[model samples]
Target: MLQLHPEQIAQRLDQLTELSVELGRGAAAGMLHGGDITPLLERIVLVAKDMTGADGGTLYRPSADGRSLEFHISINDSLGLRQGASAGVAIGVPGVALWQDDGAPNLGSVAAYAAHRRVSVNIDDVYQSGDFNFSGMRAFDGHYGYRSTSFLTVPMSDHEGELIGVLQLINAQDRETGLVKAFSATDQRFIEALAAQAAVALTNQLLLRQLEQLLESLVNLINIGIDEKSPYTGRHCQFVPELTMMLADAVHATTHGPMADFQLSENERKQLWLAGLLHDCGKITTPVHVVDKATKLETIYDRIHLVDTRFEVLLRDAEIAALKAQLASPAQADEITLALREQQALLREERDFLRHANIGGEGMSPADQERVRHIAQRRWTGPDGAERDFLDANELENLTIRFGTLTDAERKIINNHISVSIRMLEALPWPKHLQKVPEYAGGHHERMDGKGYPRGLTREQMSVPARLMAIADIFEALTACDRPYKKGKSLSESLRILGHFSLNGHIDPDLFDVFIRSKVYLAFAHKHMQPDQVDAVDEAAIPGYVP
Candidate 1:
C-alpha cells in the first residue's frame, strides 16, 4: 500500500483544507446564480476530478420515469471529451439503464449500483476487480488505446434523503509518476462531500424555478380576469404587449441610430413585455357603467328618450290649443288648424335636432351648443307632479360638453384607474427581474415635461420603456374602433395626433423618431388596424419630423 510520512500527511491535510474551502464557496455561488442546472452539474464533475486527480468523470441524473440514468455531463482531460447542455453539444453516448426491461434494478453497472444501493462504490482497479460491469469501459479503452482502471461512484442524496443523481470518477493518477492508481479513502470522502452539496443545490434551484413559474402563471391569470371583466380593456391589454414588443424589437434591430447603444436581454424584453400586458390592470376597479358610457345622454340609457317625452307633452298642449280655438270660433277653425300645423311641424324638427345632438360627436360648435340651451329654456311638467324646464341642469351640462362625451367628473373617475393600477402593482413583492414592472406600467400616462398623473414623473426621470408605452397608449386609444365614445381615427389622423404629442413633449422625442424611422407604425397597421383606418401618412406633414 502507498503511504505518506507524518510530515507529508500534514502537508496533504492542509492542502485538502484549502481545497474544501474553495470548493464550498464555488458550490454556494453555483447554487445561487448558476442560471441553469447544466452549469451546476458541469461544475460538480470538473471540481471533483480536480480534487481527486481523476483523469475523467461523468454525472448522471435519473430520467423522469427513473427507468434510465441520463448522462447529464461527460468530461475528460485524457480523451478531450466535453458533452452536454453546457457545451451545447448533443450527448452521443447511450444512457445507462437503471432498470432492466424485466423490471429489475440493473445493478451490474458501477454508477447504477451506487444509485440502486444508495451507497458509494470504490474500486482499486476495474480491470482486476470482479465487482460491477466494466465491459463498456474496456471497449472504450480498446477503441481509444486507453487503460480502464480505478473507479469511484458515489450517490448524491438531497436533504429529503432522496437520490438526486450519481457521480463517477475513473483512473486516479499517481501524484509523482503520472501512473494510474486506486482512489484512496481521502479522495472518496472529498467526493462524497461534494456530492452532498451538489444534491442540495440542485434541489433548491429546481424549487426556485418552480416558484417563478407559479408567479408568472398567476400574472397571466390576473390579466385573464381583467379581460373577462371588460373585453374592450382586455383587447387593449393584449394588443399593447404585442405592439410594445414590435417597437422594442425595432429599437433592438437598429444598428446605427440613437437606440443603437440600447438593447435588451431576453429577460429585459420579458420584463417590458409583462409590464405592457399589465399597464391598465388597475381598470379592474373602475365601474363598468362609467367605462361603457356610450354617449353624452347615456346613463342606464340615453336621456334623449326623456326629451322625446317632453316633446310629446308640447304636441299634446298644441293639439289642445287647436281644439279650444275651434270651439271658440267654428268659422275660424280652418285658420287655427293651419297655425297649429306649422307649430307642430316646428316642435318635431326641434325634437329631431336635440336627438341628433345627444349622440356624441367630435366637436360641438358654439352655435349648436347655444341652440341646445334655447331648446332647454322651453317648459315641461316633471314626474314629481311639478312644472320644470324642458332640459334639467344635468342634461344641459351633458349636451353642451365642448369635446368628447365625458364630463369633468366622469373624466376624473376614468383617470383614477392609473392611480388604482399603481396601487395594485406596488403592493406586490416582486422578484429581481420584475422589480421594474410597477414603474414601467405606472409611467404610461406620464408626460415628457412631468405633466402626468399619480406621480407625474418627468422625461429625465422616466425609463425608455415608460415613454415608449405612453406613445403606445395614446395611439391605441386613438385608433381603437371598439370604444363606446368616438369613431376610430384613420391612420393619418392618429399619426398627426401622435406627432402633436411628440412636439408638445408629451412622449419621448427620440423614441418617437425611432418609431417613425422603423416603420413600427406600418407593422402595427398591417396587424391590428382596420383597412379603412389604415390610410397613407404624409411624412413631411407629420409634426416634429425632420424628414
Candidate 2:
C-alpha cells in the first residue's frame, strides 16, 4: 500500500483542481478544431500522466466487434517515445483479446481485464503480481533494460455507462524520492475522474464526425439525383467543387495581390466544399427536354424530320401538276417537263436552307431568321387535306431563336434552377460553421457587377468563396464537351472568353487572375477535357487579363 503525507495530499488536491479546469478548456477547443478525436485522446493520456506522476501511459479503444482492445495511443516519458493513433503511426501489433479462443472472458491482460470488467485495476507491480498476465510486459522491459512497476488501469465510460476505452498508466514515481513506487488510492481516484471526462469528450467528438459524414453523404445524394436527371450535369456538379477548391488553394498559397491575406480554416474548407457540391442541386426540378435541347427545332424529338415530310409532299404535288400539264398539252411536254425540274430544284434548295437553320449555333444572323419566317409562309397540305403555313407558330419560334437551342421561356426555366437551389439549401437547418453554405452555393450564378440573377448581389456583397465558385462554374461550363448544345472550347478559346467575362464583371477579376496565373484550369482540363481540346494557350492574347 502507498501512503501520502498531509502536505502531499494538499499538493495533489491543487493539481487535481487545475487539471479539471484544463480538461474543460481542452474539450471546448477540440470541438472547434474540426472535432478531431486524436487531440482529445492525446490530451487524455498526457493529463493522466501529469496527475499521477506516471512514467508511461497507453489508451486502448475497443475494436468495433467488441472482441479486442486496440492500442490507440501510447507515450513513454522515460524512453522519449510517442506512437499510435495520435502520433500518426500505426502500432503494427495485434490487440489484446477480451475473450479467449474458447469464447470466455480471458481476464489475463490488465488492460483487457479493466475493459471487460468495466472497472479500475490498480497494481503495485506487475512482475510480483500473479493476478494478471505479465509475460509481454516482462519481455518488453527486458528488451529496453527497464523495470516495470505500478499500473493504474481505468475503464472509461460515457454518461450512459457505455465503454469508451481503457486508460493504463505505469510506474508512478514518488514526489520527492525520484523513485518509482505503487500508485496510491488517491492517484487511482483522480485518474478515474479524468478518464470519465475523456470518455464524454471522445464520444461527443465521434458523434460530431459522424454527423459531418452524414451531411456530406446527403450532399452527394443530391448530386446523384441531379446526375440521374441529366447525365451531363453530374460531372459539372463534381468538377465545379474540385476547381473551386483548387482556386481557393491557389489564393491561399499566394503572398501578393488582393487575395494574399486570404486563408481557409478546416471548418471553412469543409463548408466551401459542401457548398460547391450543392450549387446545382436545383437542376433536379428542371425538365429533361429543356435541359438537353440539342437543336433549334427540337422538342420531344427533332421537328426537322416533320419539315422534311412536308417538303416531300410539296415535291409530289409539283410533279403531279407538271404531269397534268403535259397530258393537257402533249406538243409542249418538253417545256412543261423543264419547268417541273426547275420547280423541284427550287423546293430542294429551300428545304436544305431550313435544315441548316435547325442546327443551333452561338448566334443566328437576322437574315437567317428572316429566311425562316419566309419559309414558314409557304403553303403545305397536311394529311388532313388542309393547307396551312409550312412551319407552325411554335416551330417558327423555336427555329428562329437567335442564340442557343433554348427559347426565351426555356432559358427562364434554366435560369430558375439557381433560385431553386438557393431555396433548397437555405431551408435546411445548418450549423454555425456551415450557415454560409446557402450564400456560397447561391452566388455562383451572380455577376460581379450586380447584373446577375436571383438577388443581383455585387462583388462586395458576396464572399470570396462565392466569387471563387463563380469562376469555377464558368470555367467548367466553357470547357465542358459533354454539353448537348456546344462542343468543348479549346483552352485558348475558353481563356479568351473567361478573360472577357472578367473585364465585363461577369466574374471576379481578382479570382480570375489567380485562376489564370495558377494554371488551375490546366489541371482540370487534363483530368476532364478531351486530349484534342487541351491546346497550348497564349497568355498575352487573353482579353482583359494582366498575365
Instruction: For model 1, name the residue pairs that clash.
Output: none
Encode model 1's per-residue lDDT on 148-187: one tens digit a residue.
6888999998777777899999989887888989888877
Residues 1-547 of candidate 2: C-alpha lDDT, one tens digit per residue: 6767788667767866776666666665666576655766787788789878899999899899989988899888998778885678777667889899999997999888888789899999888899999888888899888898998999998777778899999999876797999998988888887787677777776677778779888988988888988889998999999999999999889899988999987778878888999999999999989988888887788889999999999999999999999999999999999999999998999899888888888899999999999989999889999999999999999999998888999999999999999999989999897898998899998999999998999999999999999999999999999998889899889999999999998998888888888889888889888999999988888888776
True-structure RMSD, every candidate: 4.4, 2.6
Name the weakest run of 10 consecutive residues (lDDT summed) in model 1.
26-35
TM-score of each: 0.82, 0.92
| After superposition, candidate 2 runs with Cα above 4 Å error | 1-35, 64-66, 85-93, 159-162
Cα lDDT over the full model 1: 0.83
Q: How much lDDT does candidate 2 score?
A: 0.87
Candidate 1 to truth, TM: 0.82
